[model samples]
Target: MLLPTLTLLTCFLLIVTLLPISNHTHWLIRGLDFPRLQIAIAAILLLIFQLIVLEITRPSSLLLICVSGFCLFWQSWWIVPYTPLFPREVKRAEKNSQKPSLKILTANVLTPNRNSQALISLVKQHKPDVLVTLESDQWWQNQLSVLEDDMPYTIKCPLDNLYGMHVYSRLPLTETETCYLVEDGVPSMHASVRLSDRVRVRVHFLHPSPPSPTENPESQERDAELIVVAKSIADSAQPIVVTGDLNDVAWSETTRLFRKISGLLDPRIGRGMFNTFHADYPFIRWPLDHLFHSEHFTVKSIKRMPSIGSDHFPLLTTLVFSPKAIPENEGIDASAEDRSRADEIVEKENVSKSEIPQPTAHAK
Candidate 1:
């Protein structure tokens, strides 16, 4: 009876595990992508118990154990990149180099979170060169406006739909625009920031809609929106940075594709998960807030800041641009097959509307 129960549990996890490996972007399959770490841990515990506690296993049970171990190993392969045991996707900045750096603090304020003081305090402490906030309404805007004196380059879209976004940068900004790429109300920020020595770093900030029962029933729009952004930035020559709550886990296939298509590296790789969401429930958290940069940049530091009365924690990252370090880091080379998959994903939905306006002539 115990063996049967164990088998049933293993089978259930395996079903959830294998479902996400498919190319389909339905919410049911895509939702399982978030808990791969938890599932992997469970698999490891089950395998250890079966090996040590169970004895004289039947041939059928033996096969089940083998499958359990296989699943555990598979899950670990995806997670190992995000652990210190594996090498980082982006190299750390060398102390001797005098490369100019940019510090950014990106947070999702949950729209309804009224405690703007906490977020303001964190911003004051960090003193980031750029600030990106998602799900922010007019009240959040009013509260956050205190920092405008320091960061005058601004792009604001305050909406009540919980998809509002705002970006403020201390550095000079050009060609700044808020684009509604996927849904009618959803907005993303695109601009270029001029750093020291007149270097221009192209920036893209997105808060893609998540696949959920209340907000969005399907993951198709989210996946398509990400693919569109990835494809657009694939061939850009300037140093690029993309940040925001992607609403997708780092290990998901779509995210992996995004990394390949954009040729951007994740600082969280080979470090820690830096789980930022569900801050109220410690156990149910995942790294939803993300920052991905082009090959020209290397990490100075990346940290998860303390909660500011919101369900999500702000991510603070400092990066230094280094074109010479590209050869030392790892990059994913997308194949013809990968391009075909991306094309198919983009074609599935008719995403043809943008409310983005031309940048002010002086800002440009």
Candidate 2:
């Protein structure tokens, strides 16, 4: 009974594992991309039980063994970058460079989670140069306003909807704009942050919509919003860092496309998962928040912080501007086909207002 049950479970998991291989934008298909880590764990456990404990050497068992092994390898390959076994994507910041560094702290406060003390404590503990919070409402804004004294430069859009966002920075922020990138209610921030007289960096803070039954039924708009930002920027000269709760996993095809199109490198790659969502659930969580940067910078440190009474945890990343290190990191650029697909997403003619959002980028 146990052996037959195990085989059936293995087959079912395989189907879910392979479904996202196709470029389907449906919520169900895209949603499957989030659990690659969990799925890989399940496959490993099944393989161990079959070979070591169960030891059922029948022809059917042999087929299950092959399938289970393939699934494990496939998932691992997708997530290998997050493990130390893989080489770091962005080189570490060198000590002697002594370049100016910026520490950014981003957290999705889950809106209704009234406990601002945890987030406040984290900000005080880390003393980040920049602080960003998502799913924040007017109340949250009022609660966190205490940070204004130190982090004077601020950009805020506090809506009742789940997409409201706020950004606070200690450095001088110029040409800051609050934009409705794809959805009317969804807002994102773009600005130039001046680190010093000789050094300034372009920063984009985004909290794009996710594919879910209650929200977007498909991933089209979400994909389009990210592509718009990626396609608009030039990576070679200007130093750029994109951070926030992207509402998508780092390993998803859309995010990979964003990296290729924008020529940005993920610091989290070759680091760790830094899973930041579903803070209450141990078995179910994903790296929904992200920080991606151009080759002009090197990572000092990137980590996931402790919980703050919200459904999501905080992410802290410190980067030093070091254009010389650019050559050490391999750049990922979009192929001709990748550009075409990105064009289709951003400029699809048949898209509805709700599904296709015109990305607004400006300086004020």
Candidate 3:
């Protein structure tokens, strides 16, 4: 009885592990892309159990073992890049480097959660150069007003919908725009941040809706929104940083394609999966919040902040704009196939191709 039960369970796990490889946009299929880490762990433990408890004397048992091994390998292939075993995609900044550094604090302040002061305290302690809050409604905007004096440059879009977003930056900003890329209610922020007198960086903040029955029925809008952003910054010559709650894992096909198309590198590669969502459930968490940057920048420090009474624990990252380090770190380039795939994804959705006017930048 035990052997038959184990075989059935292992086969089911294999099916779930392989489902995300399909390009289908159904919420169920796309949703599987978020839990590769947990699946891999389960697969390995099952393999160990079978090896010690169940003797592989029969041919069917041998085949099951082989299939289980393959399932584990497939999941690991997608998730191993974020572990320390893989090579670092973004180089670490030298302690003596004199490059200009920018610190950014990004959080998704669950719109319904009324814990405004908790988030404000994190801002005070970290003192980031930029602050990005998603799922922020008018109430959240009013509550976060105290940060304006410290972070003068601002772009605010306080909507009742969960898609609301705000950007507060200490540095000077130019060419700033609040764009609605896919859905009218959903918004994204684009701006050129003046890091120093001689250096400027292009930054994008995004919080696309996820593939869920409650929010979005399919992942089309989320995938297209990301591709649209990727196409916009693919050929940028200046330093670039894209950060926010992407609502997708770093290893998902959509996100990997976004990296190739935009030529941006993920700092989490080889460091760790800085899982920030579901702050209350430690075991069920995955990396839904992300920060990706150009090769011209090197990581100074990156960490997940403590919970602030929201579903996502904030992410704080410090990156140094070191143009000299460009030769050492190369951005992921899109192949002809990748470019074709991205174009197809965008073509399927009726995306807002036009750029919007700059929002009123609030000042103290």
lDDT of each: 0.85, 0.86, 0.87
Model 1 steric clash pairs = none
Pairs with backbone N, CA or C atoms under 3 Å apart (clashes), candidate 2: 81-270
Regions of model 3 farther than 4 Å from truth: 352-364
**Alpha-carbon deviation at 283 in model 3, angstroms:** 0.6
> TM-score for every candidate vs. truth?
0.95, 0.93, 0.95
- Residue 118 Cα positional deviation in candidate 3, in Å, after optimal superposition: 1.6
Encode model 1's per-residue lDDT on 34-140: one tens digit a residue. Answer: 98888898998888878775663668668778888889988888888888998888899998678778899999998888989998898888899999999999999
> What's the candidate order when arranged by decreasing lDDT?
3, 2, 1
Q: Best lDDT goes to which candidate? A: 3
State the displacement of the C-alpha of residue 40, model 2, in Å, after optimal TM-score superposition: 0.2
Q: Estimate the Cα RMSD of every predicted model relative to the unseen true structure.
A: 2.7, 3.4, 3.1
Model 2, 196-239: lDDT tens digits are 77878888899999999999999988998888888766433577
Model 3: weakest 10-residue lDDT segment is 355-364
In candidate 3, which residue pairs clash? none
